[model samples]
Target: MRPSSTGAPQRQGVGRRRSLGVWLRGGAPGVWLSGGAVAIAVLMTLGLIGILAVRGLAHFWPAEVVQARYTPPGLEARLVLGQVVEQETIPAERLRSAGIALPPDSGETLTRELFKLGNRDLYGSDFVWLVGDWLQDRQTPADALVLERREWGNFYGYALEVREEGRQVAKGAAAVPELQRRLLRTRDLSERLERLEKQDIGGVNHALERLRLEGRGLELDGRLDATAQADLAARRAELEARYGELEDQLASLRQERRRDSVVLRDVEGRTLELNLARIVRAYQPNAMGLGAKLGFYGSKLWEFLSADPREANTEGGVFPAIFGTVMMTLLMAVIVTPFGVIAAIYLREYARQGPLTRTIRIAVNNLAGVPAIVYGVFGLGFFVYVLGGSLDQLFFRASLPTPTFGTPGLLWASLTLAILAVPVVIVATEEGLARIPRSIREGSLALGATQAETLWKVVLPLASPALMTGLILAVARAAGEVAPLMLVGVVKLAPSLPLDGNYPYLHLDQKIMHLGFHIYDVGFQSPNVEAARPLVYATALLLVLVIAGLNLSAVFLRNRLREKYRLLEE
Candidate 1:
């Protein structure tokens, strides 16, 4: 009886084993593992973006200014003031091991606070670490002001007096309001001065240089004559007159900029005079409401996006970097798109499917795997040293000593990135071309359409989305590439933008700033590490957004092309 019943249990066990084997054979384990890997990857990406967003966006928000009375072991008790940027708790034993004497009543863990003690000129350091036990009477004063200046980092103090031309316009807390009004006026004057110096006067200087070079060229060609000399002299006279006028205006602006000064007293009661013109902005963070803080955040974000950088690019705006990145990427897209599409078309449609063609395709694919820095080296050698030098010799002989085109600049940067991105485009476009139904081409040919005509009108339109797909990939890679750009044209700081109000607005020969390089500079090469920390995150987040924006635009165009041609395919 048991043997007959056991046959059923044996059969059941065998069935269960069979089911397990089926599950394993179906690749369920591998599927689960792959799914886990993808989920982890997605989480990691989101985490990175979320971290960047929080750290970057928070930098713009107005933090409450704290005034704490701190006393070291042997030092006199005095008011220590700043924005408390970070706080960490550590084991008391670890603090003691580090030679920091803990208070007798301290717990097992000791807290250390990082204060952004700005006012670099006065304090010699922008940050300080204080033991929590040493900090007493910590308070956020409503009148504690923060002055974001064009130089010397920042000032945290109480506004004591406002003076205009040695006369006291206001005194005590009342002076803070007057200081604000004067600061606005000074900022306007400074902006005007900047425009006059960078644009109006800078243009004149450029013209003069060009004129001198043209004269040299004339002399080299034996074309210089009394009439030419007279014309040159007259033009020089006109430029000189303009320069003098600008100089007078600049002097007046400078005088205005210096007419007002602010007297501020720090937490230690030390008084210092700051010129109103130097202050980019001022706010009482502790006094600010939610709306005021939000408005301040908006203004700061805008400044980061729109303003020219100052303080070794640790402060102010990254407009030049943003502009350069977009311009270079657009130029790269303009260049690589047609070349890549053409090459892909030739390989897929025109060229014979032979060993040579296969070899070329293999080489193109291998190019995508090449180290980016190798491309930088090639660009520096071939594009800059050789190609640019030749161009300079041929067309810019008049500006030989300066070597206008024979330098690392915007054109070479675009070209280098275009070269870097072409392989990606070629592969994408080739795949796209391969996906197109052969009957579409054959139908066009049967309808009396030439191969060229079919490609241009029908095949190409169908593949336009893929063309854009390739472009999207190209732009995403090109915009964030710092290595090739550093060798080609990128700089830490560029005084003038490549595109400006000058004739021949797009200056391909000009060295430009890039957001990727800017992030590198701010994050790694900054003089004030603590102060520059937030800027690094802000710039990085902005760069990510910019790349995303460009890619999205291309994606949008691709989707539109797909929609527009979907009916054609059907």
Candidate 2:
């Protein structure tokens, strides 16, 4: 028999309600929310990275130089030439408040362009803001030059002539090639001079210092024999003779560097002489084709990676900071891994379950939440003062008052970060150890393997991936930590790298630059904010890349270990 229409409708409604109830009960809504949240987070991260890449990477591209005449209210019209760095629209009232008079017909909001007028020495500023309406006769001159310099920031002008020893060797159309050729020569001389000063002479100085320290140590030990003294004197004489030769070569290079100079005429028709040695690279940005610009960009990027800083660190590369960050993170990993794993093994396999053990685990967990700066203070007081001072008093007594080990340095920084990261390692390792089934341990014991042997051979091999996971996390945290390193060993600019060709190749007692601190210094502490802003973005991007690279390496190792030990786990 056919069902009634109302009854059939009621049955259909019942069926729909049942399906909805089942969907809710099955957790489909929660799953959707979780997936959506993860997607949003991934998108946000990608967006942030994209912004950094766009802003930072653009700084290396050569921008066309523009020449224009700007007429400010109540001021004489003047010629201006520079790269247009930025533009913004602001309330006209704000400009008027800052002494800029706007015309009656001007809108409530006005647009202004930030010109990177370089020529810091001539203009007393690297950048200036000019209202869009006031800028007239704008043109991109192909002959306009942008001179990257070692000091006084960038110089923007038109190349006039190349002078060698006060005589005009090349001028007009031929001047750019002559200047480029002379710059190449100066670059070679500069490299040679740097090698002589930093390596050859530096080695001699280091040896002389070692000799002095040895003699002092011998004197303290009551073993300063005449033969030892004679040996020390001969070594000192040889070092001093080598130093004298380096000095002579350095002086000759300096004289040769001063021989060739480039004469440039500013937009204001004023002539200026710049030594070829001072110029890093001179390029006509407006004249460059796409291929030339790309090549220049590559070179600029390479320079940012390899060159030493100049201009109060607002310019140049961050190689030292990069080295220090990686070295410290690696050292921290080395020191923390053994301690963390040992502690975890003892807690999980050896320690009796009791109130004391529980309390210790709680403390370790709490330590992971502590402020990083507190670790810095503790490290400064204990590692730098108490323990380091004692070491200096004992092993380095001859260097007393100088305090070789009793100082904030690479060792202290690494130790501080190790302590900061240990809690993470401990927790991860403990979790990994607890995950292994009891049958695995019991089988190993039944096979006549000792507990220690079981743990070392069977358990550890399976847990290697977890160990690497902890290490990856620790490295990520330590590499980007700036607060602790600021107090421990990080400096604004390190004159020398901690690792070099010198004896005791790894100088743990020396101060080092860190990329995290470099970003902070460049972003906040730089005198030229406008000039340094791009560098800050570039450096921040570099630091993120470095941390990502380190983590990827660890992740790769972890994956390899997991694959190798998959069968054992199964």
Candidate 3:
């Protein structure tokens, strides 16, 4: 009886082991592991994007300005006016170690608030931390004014009076409306000033520079005849006359802009006279209703998207960076697609299946894994120094010492990114070509088409989807590349876009701003850490969106091509 019972238990254990082995062999565990990994990766990505969005998008929202009397231990009570930017709890002991006093009744931890005291010219800092407990008589005054400035960061105070040419135009309750009305005038004048400076004067300067270069070219070519010299002088005189006229217009516009000023009294009761031209926008946040705040937010957001960056790139828009990134990526796609497709076609269709071909294929695959900085170095050496120098010597000799194409610029940046992205394209294209059935080629040949005809009309059309797929991959990789662009062409601030109203408008030999590099510059290299922090987040989010937008465009084209060729594949 005992032996039979032991045998039954042993049999049950054997049955359990068999079931476990079967489950393992079915691959359920591997499937679950892969799914879990993918889920974790997706969750992490979403969390990061959420953080970026929250931190970035909130910067444009106008928060009510707080007025309070703060009394710190051993310090006199003073009025503080600014926005409460952040709040945190710190240990009481830590505060004491930092030479801050806490009351004896204070518990283990004490809360503090960070204020954006934006009268930087007065306080010498944009931010200050004060103990929440020490703040008394906190209020959001409806008359508190926040001035968004082009320089010296932001100014927070109350409106005192509006002035025109040192005369008080309006005061007391009437000043705000008068200031707003005059601000409109200043904006119009400022726009005119900018147009005269950048367009009229800039065009004259461009023409003058071209004339100078032309004369240099004529001299270099030994063609500086009396007629040519006289013609050049006449054109120069004409451009100078135009420039003088534009400068007069610019001076008049500036005088009009500087005509109006506003008197603002800060919390310290000291008054400041700010020119209307310096203030980009002004509003009392506490006085703004929800609808007005929303409208203001939308305008600020639009400005961030379309305006040029100001205040060391901690304020204003990233339009130049956006334009440059898209331009370079498109140029890279245009340059890389044909080269990658041709190489792929050769490797798959023309090359003999030998050891040399295999070795070349292996090398091409390995190039994709190479560090991007290595490509930058190679581009700087070969593309910029070698090829570009040759081009400059041959064609742009008049701009020799200045080095037009010989310098790091947009062309080299695009070319470098193309080289960096080509390997992926080649591999993707090769895979695509390999997938085409051999019978399709043979069938085309049987119908009297030549090899080239069959390849171009029959095979290549079928492979268009593959070409787009490769382009999508290339753009996805290249658009976010910063290290290579930094060495090739990207700059912290590009004064003008690569594309402008000038003849031969697309200036490939000009430096350009990139979204990736802007994020890097604003986040790491900026001197105002607190002010730049929000901009860093905003710019990072923008870059991601830009890359995603570019990828989606390529993806859409790829899908369309795939749909067009779906029947052929079947």
Residue 506 error for model 3, in Å?
A: 0.3
Q: What would the per-residue lDDT of candidate 3 be over residues 166-258, giving only the tens digit for each residue?
A: 999999989998988988888888888877888778878988999999999999999999999999999999999988888888888787789
CA lDDT, candidate 3, residue 487: 93
TM-score of each model, in listed order: 0.96, 0.98, 0.96
In the order shown, the candidates' Cα RMSDs to the true structure are 2.0, 1.2, 2.2
What is the per-residue lDDT of model 2 for residues 227-315, given as tens digits with 9 covering 90 to 100?
99999899889889888988888899899988999999999998999989889999998999999999999999999999888898988
- Looking at candidate 3, the ten consecutive residues that score lowest on lDDT are 1-10
Q: Which residue pairs in candidate 1 collide? A: none
Candidate 2 TM-score, C-alpha based: 0.98
Best candidate (score: TM-score): 2
Tens-digit per-residue lDDT, 226-340, candidate 1 = 9999999999999999999999999998998999998999988899988888888989999999999989999998998998899999888999999999999999999998899
Model 2: colliding residue pairs: none
Query: What residue pairs are clashing in model 3?
Result: none
Q: Give me the runs in candidate 2 sitting further than 4 Å from their true place.
A: none
Ranking by TM-score: 2, 3, 1
